[model samples]
Target chain A: MAPTFTTLGYLTAGLYTASLACYLRKLFAEGKWAGRAATLLLAAGLATHYFALLVRAYSIHSVPYQDLYGSTSLLAWFLVLTYLGLELIHGERAMGAFILPLVLLLLMLDFVATPHAAPAAPARGSVFALHVTSNILAYSAFTLSFVYSVVYLVQDRLLRGRRPIAIMWRLPPLEDLERMARSGVWVGLASLMVGIGFGMVVDRQVTGAMLQFDPKVVISFLILGFYVLYLTVSRSPAWRGARASVLCVVNYFAVVFSYTAVNLFFSRFHRFY
Target chain B: MSVYLLGVNHRTAGVALRERLHFSLEDGVRAGESLRRDGLVDEVVVLSTCNRSEVYSVVAQGAAQPEGGLERYFCSFHSIEPAQLNGCLYHRRDRDAVEHLYRVAAGLDSMLLGEAEILCQVRETYLAAQRAGLTGPILNRLFQAGLEVGKRVRAETRLGAQAMSVASAAMKLAEQIFGALKNNSAAVFGSGAMGAKAAQQLRSRGIGRLWVANRTPEHARELAARVGAQWAPWEKSAELLAQVDIVVTSVAGSEWSLTREALAAAMHARGNRRMFLIDLGVPRNIDPAAAGLYNVFLYGVDDLEEIVEQNRQARESEVPRAEAIVREHVEKFAAWQSGANAVAALADLRRKLRLQREIFTDAHREELAQFPAEERERILRLMDELVEDLLREPSERLMKDREVRERAVLLRDLFGLNAPDSSRRGGE
Candidate 1:
């Protein structure tokens, strides 16, 4: 039997929850096996989440990100997927404790919003799907960047303080966190740029206009400006590390606002719900 | 034969006594060979480090007895008086010796808990002993098990995983900023002891470029030459600061050598590249406020010490886990040791049983001569089967039982199967 989107989403939630538990245990425990277990569980969760999205897309006969519930799930999936890649590259699993909870939170929100999703004609066309998918993917990337920034601040504070925080050693180095965050932003920025480009094409095709004053479009451009400014000033000596991290962190909130409030109320053509 | 250990470590002796008792590699080889030649031990390995000097050996059961003799030999080899080792030297035998060596190799017995150097030292000593032909089956298995214990403890616990010294802490912090120092440059602001140590550490890390600057050009040049670094003029601090990714200052005096404003200016010139400042001076060479500057990471001696303490605590926290891993490996080695000993005992049992069969056959030779040759051969074959059937269960039990060693010993005693003395048998 074909699984419903809600069922698949719940399955991902369970896996992510278990993965989060392993990560938390790893933080307080001395055993490296916990870290390995956590990464494996997260990878398993990511696989399940991907399969869930495919099932949703198959059942609906359209891309999964066409609706708010599915879009949130996709975003959660991308966040974990990106984090797994970073964890693999860095060979650090401590960050998973921080990243997986956000993933679970998004999944929870998806579960809450799933029941309210109305039956409607599935959104069609590859460009529109590309527009939505890339935008969500960018948001996922930025979310990870924000988490890294937060960790960077905590590590910096811990390093600066007189007392030695027990968990501080487990956290990644301040510069490593910053680098990971920067990579997150760059990947996000590039993805967002592509999303916007596709959005423009979709706009022109649908409305016979080259541009629109849609609130989502404007706010995305503003988010783009925030990251562009971040990338530019972060290279400068006076603003590179902590200041740059703070900038990206604040920019991520702007991304959050645009993804939530702007999409819900103000954005006209960009509303998926 | 079993493992035996005699040693003096930081816990039991002062540095003067330890140094007096210390052995170089040549000394270790000589000692191992002399002990083996003199029939004191069948096999031997000497583990000597700054904190401790230990001799691990495989001696015949009960031979290392009167343990004072081994202690006296150790003292005499180093030309130290037995009176000097009074209450300072320790001795362990059999399982205790096995556990002690495991603990030492795993760094639990280190002066600094979980220090990694001992593991390498242990490995080197074992390899040296092997190269010198000082080890046999028993010591070979024991040292192999010791190395395995070290690796398992390291892999399974957080012990030896964190930087526990000030210099190491500084390197850790630097690595935090620059993932790998091989691509980064550093400048040391003084050529004093602290500065020299910092410069040496930076060079060891393979920093791309290093600059040593001091008030006296000669001192700076000497320090630079020692570390393969460039000697920068003391006046060129700003230019050095502008170019280097890291700055370590240990300049003397109450006056700040690198002030906030100067660092701010350097930051501007470098276009705000990230910089790490390690202040190892008593009076503090860099301004405390410079840490507030963008991309400038400033750490003082206190901060580094804090990191070291934290690391120490972290390593300390893993002790129970590391000990558990050590215990697990020790038990495993014990099982294998017993099994190995049992294999020998089992062979002896088979030999004794066959001897008994041969005796019975010789006794029946006159009776067999009266029967036909073929009938006599069949009767002999039947007697062989009877002996095999009688001994099969005990033989299998000796190999498979949990108390195989005990059973083997019991069997040897009951059958009067006295094996050859281990002293004559050497390591096996």
Candidate 2:
């Protein structure tokens, strides 16, 4: 059963990445053919990804939030969901043309690392479900913010260089990217807020505090602080674009360190494990 | 088929000559009627712009000798000496006419080569001709394709990206001096075309004040009124010259003017402040000898033209890409035209098929008269269904095919349904 899900996850990730790569090439050249193909590929990939997530849920039962493996899969699913939601609202396929591949990459890394389900993982409960879901969704928003920040960096560079209209025309305008980054930070904040709420609830229902004061937790708080500062400064207009992008980039690395790097090496307090 | 275009342009004729022969909107309306009236052309379209005025026409394949009445009509209508105008004029017929209009729209034929305004001017001229009821498919297709080509080039090339025109170059010079043109004052010499254009450019640059000085006071006043600039008489050109920091001159006047003596006094009064001077006059206004004076910098049209040429070359690099788009649109338009022509041919075929069906039904009427009524009705239904089935696909397919469009056009001519031009324009 693990093999079935593992294989589906691999196939879905490969297909999703291929779709994004193909669409990116088309958008840079002949927009019409690429536009049509990108939409179709995204829709198809989302369907397969949805199926794989459901299969993983059933195979493990209890919503697949066990340790590193289940949480990684859940985060990957959240990323895809957040992406599709934005795509539906904006009617812009370019975001998916950049985003889905990143999501797939994270999932693929999780697959290769192949973290086993922890024996100490909790049993089925609404509290655990709510805790993992909120945390992963917040991480998903961070993932998206990270993507736009990188795009903003490149676009801002080109705009300053006095590029011809066509070269940078493919990207969303600088103003649009800034707005998208702000929204991403807001959503990430909402996810962190809910995740923290669920953690307290879990602490109450279980014997003691299930979350340890691990280095990973501290780093996660610092990352959350950096972005909150970013958002607070963003209201002032002085802390936008490059300042915002830099903060988002740092936060993205913090997520990587907290979720994957610390889980793989440092300590045993990884809640997923 | 060869189509030639002939006209006097800004390069070929002086401003006085060009202004004298310039075609006003009303004159074009009248000229459109006269070109057809005098039987000099089988079809004619006139493209008259500020920089150029050309007549594009489709003449007879072979002709009997007749007076060149269109030429005579143009000269008499303008009340100009035929001898004086004839030397400046050029004539291009056949393919040249189409290519010239295309080049004009592409900005290749303008005084400022690769400028964008000519395309819009061509469209206006085409519409004016059309309104006068002087246009046919050949002219209509040519102008429409030319406009498309213009759009294609601008989209695919760096032509518009480069700042090279005299007006744009002057703007660039201002940008260099002021860093930003939020509040600069500039004096423009000679209220002629280029000077007026330069003053307008200065105003657009957000200049705080604009002054116009011309060889003629009324002309300067006219230009100043148009551009909202203060006018100075030509004799006081030196006295008022010290007031502004930037001076742009365009004197397509009869002789070299604005000597070293005139500018030296102005520079002395200006207290050695840096002033940019651009001289666009062909007869050499703001004499090169004036550059020795301090606080005075002067540049000529050739220097400006070189910059524009560089811009032109940059634009030329993008030509292939733009031409590719043009070719696509040209083919697309041709396909559309073919499809349109097919409608007529399909109509004709349908009419013939219906007539044949009627004749076949009539001939069988007698044979059916001897049969029982029920059998006859059944046979007639079969015949009608078969004819409908057979005609439907061929007619629709023929209407859809591109190759058949030309054949359809030929067929229309053969069938005597080549409706008159009036009905065509009125959408018959």
Candidate 3:
């Protein structure tokens, strides 16, 4: 079963890579067929990735978010979902070349790290499962926001520098990139708020306390605060374009620290295999 | 009989020559009717646009070529000397003609690559010929196929996606700055041709609340009415600039029309909302320094040229793909024409066989009068069976065998199976 899941994981990654190639081809060429094929391939990869997650959960006899590898895989899956959702809504696929590689990297990491799965920790109930799932989803949304902000900045630089390249034509319009990033931030902030709410509930039930000063908790709040600040600043026209994009990028780093550094070396209550 | 296309385009002829040879709708109708009536061509459709004038026709096989062909007919109808028009005219016959028509309809052959006006011109030409009672089955099928090819190329390739003109490029830049123009208001300063074109493009893009302002109030009002936009006074540029999300200026002068200070004040009034300014004038209209302000995007004529060049290159790169599509359709049309010819040949052969049987039977009627009616009927049926058996192998070969397919016209001529009906000669 583990071998089968591993094969599925590899197949999913391979499909995503193929989709990325098709998108890149479309960016340079002028054919609708390439864009359509890329989209179909990406959706296929997402299906296989979902199946792999289900199989992993079944094999381990628990939700797949019990450890670092499983949670990262879930995060990668949500990232693809968010991106695909945006693509469908906007009918824009040029950004897929920039975005799908990040998803593939996370999935590859999951594939490599899951083989050395550590011993299972004590069982956590549905509340803890929900909390972890929402938190990972929030992180996924923030990652997408990070990608859009980076694209927005690149487009801004190209337009301002008056050094337009072939890729400039393929990138989404600057306004569209900014709007997509703002939408991602909204998703991220809302999910983070809900996830933290559930986290507080679980902490109260398990430790008979509401606010345990865990390092992960502290960093999660910091990440949430940064995004909230970004949202606030984005409403003002003066802080809207480059300034807002920069702040979004900065918030993503805090997200990285919370998801990785705090999980690996700092947090006690949230430490996992 | 085969289809032929003869014409000159911007590449092959100068504007002076093209204008002299240009055909209006009435002129095309007259030419098509005269050509068909004179038996110079079996069917005709004349496509005339600013960039090209093409005449598509079907002529009889083995017709008198030099004295009464399409070229001489075109020259005589237009009262132009054949020698003078010789250098400008190009001729494509049969499959090549079909391919040329498709390419023209698809905009691949336009002066500006992927421009769409030629398609509409072709459609109108076809309809005009049709209304004049000049089109037959062959020409009809060809024009329909050309139109479909045009639509497919546009949908399947990005050939028609980019803007090739400065006016359109400015609109594209505005779209990049503001995602959807549907909610954005735009103001066009100066009622010159370029500014008017930019306003028209913006209106076509569904920009809301378009305002036209010019140094001359009458020109501004006229331009605004023409494009269905509101006219604003030139002195109200500050208020208009603050209200509109986009501003396009094409006013000509040595001095600046919109300085940075005025724009800054407008920006401040609008709460620093994102604004796109396009200056298409010489010596500059909008101050270039305004680009440095936050949330303000400014582009001049030179900046738009970069986009136009990029778009041109992109369209040029897609030429090969568009050509491939044209080639595929041309081949399909050739195959269909082959099948059509084969069908015509088979029908002719059957008709000839029936005529021969009737003549032989009529000649032997006296001898058959000696026998009973039933016996005569059996004898006639036997003769019919023999004819069917004798022709079966050749009929199947005509449809299937490529080597035999080329002999279809020869067989038709050998059997003297030419239709007495001139209408069928035009097409089915």
Candidate 4:
């Protein structure tokens, strides 16, 4: 018998957990090999995650973003991808200890929340795939922005409090955190705008509707607006550091609301799966 | 022979004593040469820096009262009386000396832990000794191993990662703000000593453009010329603020030299590009409220102190790991030293065996001359192999067993290997 998506998903979670342990070792102890080990494990976890998504897509004969479970899984995959990219670009491994735990949590949630069987109303077609993929990528970028914002705030607090802990020493510098946050916001805002555009196109194609009054659609646009405001205000001298980080955090909540509350409670016509 | 280190460092000696004992490069070379020339030490290297003065030497294994002689020689060389240097000196022999040298090279023994200058000092001292023809095989191996252990400790531990000084703390903080300072411009807000030091540190880290601003334009220009930076007029603070990526303020004053409003206006005009402000003043030259402004990272003396203290603590925590590396290398060097000691015994054994082989060949000279040339060559080859085979076990034992190595000199004496007439005895 072939290996199932659920098993591969569990394996991905295990790999991520191992990677997290290695990253923590690197952060706490002066282990020479721990960093390279952590990077390798994270790369392995990413590969397993991609394989799991592929398995799901093949088993269901549709894209992996056809349901809430698959979309969350894709978001987790993108988060790992973005983190790996940052790690490669920066040559810094300390952030992995903080990031891999979030990846593990999302993967575990995907496992617990996703159904064993495919949903009756599957989100099919290339337009739906493009739309969902873009949205998940946007959410993933937003999630990374949220993480960087939290790091920035924590570093700021540590600096201002005049209490430099060992963990604070291990963290990336405040400026690097801020730059990473800004990059995340830029990518997120662009992906979100493109996702909304594709969502509108899919909406018109499927239901002959121009502007649906769906809560998910409205909240996503609201989240977009929040980030657009963040991008503008963060450029000004007054709102750059703590204020900008707070704005990113606030926008992340809107993302959580759209991903969960709007999909579970309020969305009807916008529910593609 | 054994390696020995006799030294005084910042921890053991005050600045007065250290200054008295400090050796310049020329003094080090002269001292190393004189020590070796006087037959006091087989090999010697003298290392002297701001924080330390050390004599690393190789002496004959059983030399009587070597340490006392070395101590007296060190005192007299520096023209210091023994009474003045009695309590300030430390002596380590053999393994302890090796470990001390490794620790010094690795910066563990530095006043500022993990400072990198000592490694270069170690290299220079070794080179000076070598140029003076003072170092032999043992000192060469010890110094080379010391340098390697230093590099390994730095590469394998976090001891060398953080900044321990105020100037370095500023550079580290600037690095945090701007990942690389290679393309960044900085303006020093005063022509004070601290500002000049900070500017030098920044320039050392590859700051592209540097500006010195001061209340006295002439002083600013003088400092700029001294440090190879540009002098910006004192009244051009706002323009400098708008242009530079870093601003180091060391002006002595009670009032803030850089206010929040002024920085805010500058930030607005600069389109909120990221800027780092290092306030080295007591009352804080940059206003604390300026940190609230966008893209302005303001670190005062207290903030830098926190970072420096934390870094010092971190380096202290890494001492055990770095010491472990040093200890490992010390043990390896000790083993190599032992193996080196066994080399003489092995060579003596080979010489004795060759003497025995020649005696046997001479006794059978008539019988060997009766054989053909090919047969005679084969017999000589057999005798060479037999001698080698006969000594292989003893040679292996000499390298591995301490008891066997101790008995080697007895065996050499029994075989008359050290006698001047031993080779002629075989012919007689």
List, for all models, the DockQ compared with the true complex: 0.49, 0.03, 0.45, 0.35
TM-score for each predicted model, relative to the true structure? 0.87, 0.57, 0.87, 0.81
Residues B263-313, candidate 2: write the lDDT tens digits: 777766765454667888877778787765543556677766665565567
lDDT tens digits, residues A54-120, model 3?
Answer: 9888887778776666777899899999999999999989889888888878876754664555567
Clashing pairs for model 3 are none
Candidate 4 accuracy as TM-score: 0.81
- Candidate 1 chain A has its poorest 10 consecutive residues by lDDT at A114-123
lDDT of 1 by residue, A116-228 (tens): 54446444478877887888889999999999999988777655553447677678877788888989999999999999999889888888887899888889999999999
lDDT digits (tens) for residues A87-189 of candidate 2? 6776656666678767666676664765565564367388767876888899889989899888877765543332323435456655567678888889998
lDDT of 2 at A271: 43
| Best DockQ among the predictions, by candidate number | 1
Q: Is 2 or 4 the stronger prediction by TM-score?
A: 4
Order the candidate numbers by DockQ, best to worst.
Answer: 1, 3, 4, 2
- CAPRI-style quality class for the chain A–B interface of candidate 4: acceptable
Writing each residue's lDDT as its tens digit, candidate 4 over A232-262 gives 9976766877789999999899999888888
Interface RMSD per candidate (angstroms): 2.6, 14.4, 2.4, 3.2
Please tell me the TM-score of chain A for candidate 3. Answer: 0.95
